[model samples]
Target: MSESAPTRPLLNLDALFDNPVFAGGFGLASLGAVLAFARRGAISTVGLIRRRMLVNVEISRQDPSYPWILAWLSQPREQTSFLARRLTRINKLSVTTTTSVTANGPTRASFFLQPGYGRHVIKYKHAYIVVSREKQATAKTNTGEPHETVELTTLYAHRHIFEDVFTEARALALQAHEGKTVVYSVRNFDWVPLGEPRRKRPLGSVILDEGVKERIVDDAKDFLARRQWYVDRGIPYRRGYLLYGPPGSGKSSFIQALAGELDFSVAMVNLSEIGVTDDKLAFLLTKLPERTILLLEDADSAFINRRKREADGYSGGTVTFSGLLNALDGLSAGEERIAFLTTNHIELLDPALIRPGRVDLMVHIGGATRYQAAQMWDRFYGDVDVDGAYRERFLKRLDELELFGEAKEGQPVTRTSTAAIQGLFLFNKNDMDGAISMAEGLIPPKLEAEQ
Candidate 1:
């Protein structure tokens, strides 16, 4: 049997007014007229009110005195009953509209209001947001007319997505002005792309075997904690990490993993490809976007054997040791900047660059541990559980071979030789499954493996 569809409810205007309570209420006839107008136009009461408000505002703008007369004529009883409240709301709305129009003139004025402080106007154009100090001055026009002019001096241009970072920086600047905090200004740095040959593989792609993943996570957590602590203390929250290890020890992979985990964009700067002098380098650093991870890969190669005072013909002129130092920790040092320097040889780096005040953390990634090797075996073989006896024998063999060290307590571990471990795992490709099972037994469980 077919069921009948339900009927929708309809508004009964007559019945609504027939009720003595509603009829006796104030402005009942006016309210009825409003409803009737809405029904005739197939519009809602909200739409009608909005249209009336806009019409009134337009009329008031054309004839500034018309609003008072219109209010008196349209709702004399309301004005008499709630004159103060109505006028207060109307005045606030008018002022708000006027301020909005003034602020959003020919050029948009970006302004934000802080609870305790006043409004701050942000000037944004192109890809930069200009932050400046606004000052009022009097100027004479060509016609000999005097007028007040607001002059703005550019303080900085922060890139997009770094707005929060800049906001914090601005707060820090304010505190510095009040002698409550130290202010560091970051130097401006430009990102110049190299016209080098493109590789067939995708840029910034890192592959991790199971064993190395765990270690990366642990180290990343530590890094994030340190960053948070700086933010909480309102300190210059910049971090400088040094990633050094063998060529194929997954140094780059670890970097990519960290960037991915932190959800920060990686801005890789190949120093060898940079043709800028010390002055330009300092500028680029100041202008780098906040909350960004700047990667200086192969830093050792860029400065290797180069004298600090040498005058190399570059785009920004001669670079000096003093200039380099100023560029790194100049007035424009921003708190949210994160810089990573990776090198194959740690010994090749200048002592100034690796100093405690320069790079905050120095992480040395060495060869893979035995735990890492076994984890890699399990990943490649897709077998978590292997024969216990065979695994023990294999582990003994690994210990005798000294393939990976035993996991120690209260000490930082290294998992460098990942490539070598991977190669070893694939050596017995014929019986890969059996080989993995045997290898797992030999690896110690105390050493944590990355996934």
Candidate 2:
């Protein structure tokens, strides 16, 4: 190769500047200074100016405060903004488990979940307070005059470390007996899930016998007709139904079937499991989605027993009466929400709760009858074509089984079941045919007697 002038490797300035030995000595000192400044909440002069300008811009967007600023600055007078004055009073009061501070003064304290922001700081003559976006704080009246503690951290860290603590604190606050005028808005009753369940069983997947399906379709048709009528008249469209039957008689299944038939979502609430006050109950109701089927399962017992106990005997006696009234027909019970109440004993329900307007329909799902049993047998055996003698024998027995009702005038004779015999036979693949035949045999004699 020709002897060429050696080329420098791009002057190597970056390599020289990035020497680990030099970096270790200089970077540590610089980092320590920055940390000290941050701890003291001291911003550089240039950064302070920039922040002031940004805050002023935010203020100007709200109103032309220039005139007031100039007046106050020129006169050297102290004046507090409305927000500042309000926050000032909020900072003074100590809250205990049973007390709450009003917006008017620190004397009134109420328990509230600290939002995404960190604990509130009272400063600047109590006229200015800082609420950080990092942490959250809540206050409650201490029963033993205990002082409140303010937590400080970023929202991410706080949520990770103190979520359970916050939850328990919130629960205690909700349970505390504070004598205050509770104002429950109708919107509060509406409830939406914070996060959807990772695994959800679809309502449509519920298995129902043909007889139940027919009943659901019939009820849906009737409901739709009435709903459409109301819509035509420009009235608030609302319907309430009470489903009362023995447990495991498919009361829940029937409701699910109706929901599937109507193409509506079922919002189920176990009144017994809802551990909240009347105000919270109203909040949940108000929050319910429109066009939804609000199902209160076991509502009779839930209201009379479970809820009553939670209300300290006030619920069943008087408080629950008032609370239920508000829950059912209050201003929040908007026009489009449909309600269904299911109970094993309708007798336990208060008349006011199930009155004409509140519960428009009372459906009685009694024990399965023989007619229902025959239909279930038919459903199990319908597809199989037996020999002529067997078919004739089956028909005769079906008629006598006492499960078939007279077809309504001008309507097709649809086989319907009065019992859950299908469920009984669904898993018995080996005995299904024989069991069905036996059920048919019971029917023929009843048909002969009726004829």
Best by lDDT: 2
CA lDDT, candidate 1, residue 82: 53
Task: State, as a TM-score between 0 and 1, how close model 1 is to the true structure.
Answer: 0.43
Worst 10 residues of 2 by lDDT: 55-64
Q: Any runs in candidate 2 off by more than 4 Å, and if so which?
A: 1-235, 274-277, 302-319, 385-420, 436-451
User: What is candidate 2's CA lDDT for residue 253?
Assistant: 66
Runs in model 1 deviating more than 4 A are 1-234, 274-280, 302-305, 308-328, 384-416, 423-451
Candidate 2 structure, TM-score to reference: 0.44
Worst 10 residues of 1 by lDDT: 91-100
Cα lDDT of candidate 1 equals 0.49
